[model samples]
Target: MTGTDQQPVSASLRIDGKDAELEQRLDDELTAFNAAATGAGAPEPLSVRVTDAEGALVGGLTAWVWGSCCAVDMLWVRADQRHAGWGGKLLRAAEEEGARRGCTEVIVSSFTFQAPDFYRGQGYRETGRTEGIPGGHEDVHFHKVLAG
Candidate 1:
């Protein structure tokens, strides 16, 4: 093989404590590479937050928008505020924002012990599940088509 085809060998490896700078640099590099490879552009963050009259956080949803998809990373509501329907409102707002940003679908996952049925109530269909999480539970994935 030609010299140009030879892969460089790593001489050492070091495991270190958390470094924010290194984490940011790695994220930036990988994001650029993914954008270039998939033509999806860099993932943009989308969030929906709920607060009380005193501005105390009640619940929130966080997600990343890439190409035509919005992936919900977290959805949480204060225990006291949960059954009052804030979760649905937050999710609907996120979906609307995603549709406004040109996304056609949204995806989210929940642990079996968490809110798997909640997503279903919001019209998200179960797409898959990963078994054998602690305590014999599963990670359930869901998908929903945004209404334009």
Candidate 2:
């Protein structure tokens, strides 16, 4: 495998496809990093879902609590549900839970067309930016220091 100067791509991305073995291996590696940083075992996932009056799914927040930080992986509300305070409510819930778990900061990223401004409004300060990414938009990273 090392001597070949030219060879077909042996690895497949398998987008939207499940590779349980690979997934578990990656998780194990990441968890090791988490343990080293926090001595708190693996990163624990935190999620909150929103539903309509009929209990239909509408939106949710997904985060990983690791070390002293909560990494927000996804925050989404339905298009029709926008601008109704739901986004803020969900964000607060996630942040509160993180705080309760002794998390001292939150990290999240958003595309330019996404919630960069909203994250700023929620007290998240820009840590870095990647320009011209994923086409025309910039990707922004934010970090918030939680109040003790």
The best candidate by lDDT is: 1
* Clashing residue pairs in candidate 2 (N, C-alpha, C atoms within 3 angstroms): none
Against the true structure, what is each candidate's TM-score? 0.90, 0.83
Supply the TM-score for candidate 2: 0.83
* Candidate with best TM-score: 1
Tens-place lDDT digits, model 1, residues 31-109: 9999999999999999999999999999999999999999999999999988999999999999999998999999999
Residue 90 error, candidate 2, Å: 0.6
Q: Candidate 1, which segments miss by more than 4 Å at Cα?
A: 2-6
lDDT (tens digit, per residue) of candidate 2 on 71-147: 99999999999988888999999999999998999999999989899999999999999998877889999999999
lDDT of 1 at 142: 99
Error of 1 at 131 (Å): 2.2
Candidate 2 clashes: the total is 0
